[model samples]
Target chain A: MTLSIVKNATCTFCGCVCDDIELHAEGEKIVKTKGACSLGESWFKHHTAERLYPDALIDGKPATVDHAVEAAANYLYDANMPLVYGLSNITCEAQREAVFLAEIIGGVIDSHTSL
Target chain B: MIYWGGNPAECHPRHFTKYSLTQKGKFIPNGRKDRTMVLVDIRETPSAKAADLFLQIRPGKDFEVITALRAIIKDQPVNPKSVAETGLTVEQLQDLVKQMKAARFGIIFFGMGLSMTRGKHMNSAGVLMLAAEMNAFTKFVAMPMRGHGNVTGSDMVMRWSTGYPFGVNLCRGYPRFNPGEYSTVDLLVRGDNDAALILGADPGATMPQPGIDHLARIPTIVLDPKVTHTSRISRVHITTAATGVSAPGTVYRMDEIPLPLRPALKSPYPTDEEVIRRIREAVAKKPAWRPSPNGQMAIV
Candidate 1:
């Protein structure tokens, strides 16, 4: 297998958000990570392109992505006071989307900082 | 440099080597040799080994300690007996104030130990106030040691979008700010919210018992890369690509500096941004929930 190297890959494991790590990937997995601490190394190595779980789940049962999305939307729309929480581990793009969703659904939006 | 209520040695392993202590900066030529490190916490963690001076304070006394320091810096009279209750004497506080005033540059990095304790925000406020007052003697600043990835980014995004950082409410069609009322933990524990959409965090594992029970009672939706603790209990769990690993986007440092993520491998799942946008689009397709223009409040 050919090894592919990516330089200056960012690690979002902690608040430091170290961005100088070097990632070495083989096929679907990250084999080695240089310049990253132990936490960051495990973060990079833990995630792989391989499918580990079902795409979506509804009420502990396997369901299609479309069905799950609709179910989620229906729940949020039907509720009087819905909440959108937990933006700690995701990216800024997703956070923006979450804020918009909260606004449209007339809900409260909070992050881990409040905890 | 002062590390207050934080264990950087174990929590942020590279903080000493990468950012604060050992780095040779323009002002400090000798790096570690020229700088003095102080640590203040309830217990002696591994980080105490790295500090030149360690002060083990009594738990729940952060506010009192910080206030005492503030008084000492301003030359205000403080009762020695009262100071002793904080697990540090007035003499020790005087010496610390001396060192702080003598330094050319000073910084205080406070962590969750100060923020999540009994006094909570008041403790943080005392630290910030102390740092601001220290500027009268030297260049001193204080920063919180934020936890989790992109938490800072979420604060930034929410600030620019809604005019508030966190604990924002838009139920009235405009942004309203109230922490104890709108914050997730308080809302969940009080059973105020009827439904929830949780992303990027596992509150089921970390929240208080009442909050966890409320989440279980509500229709909770989770979006994450794996089937996490929250996912198992949620009504809908959507698998998404992991940020900074298989999904590319932006993350912010604790200092609020933005950094771009470069993925090394392709993932089979959609990104959180895509999933949220799809959910929003689906919600938009439903009938509008907007108030009539006659009852609409104007944005002043």
Candidate 2:
């Protein structure tokens, strides 16, 4: 088995965000991790593109993301109560959506930090 | 020279080994040997074992200890008994103050042990005050050991956008800072919220039990690259490419150092930015102004 080494991969598990991890991948699987702590090691070694469900769900029914989002917008638009939470773990760009959605719908917004 | 609260050995193991504790410095070429190490905590941590001095204080007594230290640094006589409430001796406090005053450069790194406990704000202020006082005699600095890959980045962004960081309210087209009233926990537990649009966060696992339970009962939309606990509970989940892994992006460390992410493989999933942009576009669609049944111009 040939190991393909990839260096300078950042571990997003914790606040440290250690960027020195080197992944040794055998085919599509990460075979080993170097220059990383246990947390970093486990994350880089196990983190993958596995999806829990392929189709986006609107009330448990399969639908495209756009369709689901449309449904979500309708629900939120009609609702008297709405909250926009999370957004801390995501990219800065994605967070803008939560903020925008909350403002448009006259809802409250908060992140994981409130925990 | 002093590590208060945080366990670098666990929270920031790489940082401890690579930068703070063992790394060689220009002023101190001998690395660990040339510098003094002090660990202060409520319990023994791996970092304490490596420190030259370990001052295990009573929990919630950080404010007292910090105040006492500041008093000593300012040439004021500190009441040993009062300071000892933190489980340290007058002699130890004196020695610590003396060492800090004598050092060419002194530094303190504190964590949630001080910030998250009772008197958190006071404790933080005490440490900074102590560091500032020590500057009169020697160079001293203090900082918190941050968590999350881009928490600092988030703070930086928040500051740039608003005058504050975290718990910022922009409902009025203006930013407002109020931690308790507008914070996530308060908003959720108080039942002031009904729906949530979760992006890159997991309050399900981290929030208080009440907050978590309430979140599960609400209309939550989770946007992540992986199937996290929050995503599983979300009514609408959109999987995106993982930042710093399948997607090339920039991440910030605890100290706000930006690092470039090297993508190991290209992801088939959409990037977070794209999905969010699409959602925004969808929500922004509004009916144009139209005449009502009576021919009066009214928005529909």
Best by TM-score: 1
TM-score of chain A of each: 0.97, 0.77
| Residue ranges of candidate 1 with Cα displaced over 4 Å | B290-300
RMSD of each: 2.5, 4.7
lDDT of 2 by residue, B245-289 (tens): 666666566666766777675567777767777766676685423
Q: Worst ten-residue run, lDDT, model 2 chain B?
A: B288-297
Model 2 spans with C-alpha error above 4 angstroms: A1-4, A72-88, A92-115, B287-300
Tell me the docking grade of candidate 2: acceptable
CA lDDT, candidate 2, residue B183 = 79
lDDT by residue for model 1 (B1-300), tens: 999989989999888998889999898889999899999999999999999999999999999999999999999999999999999999999999999999999999999999888788788889999999999988999988888889999999999999999999998889999878888888999999999999978999999999999999999999999999999889999999999999999999998899999999999999999999999999988876864467543323
DockQ of each: 0.81, 0.48
Compared to the true structure, candidate 2 yields what TM-score? 0.86
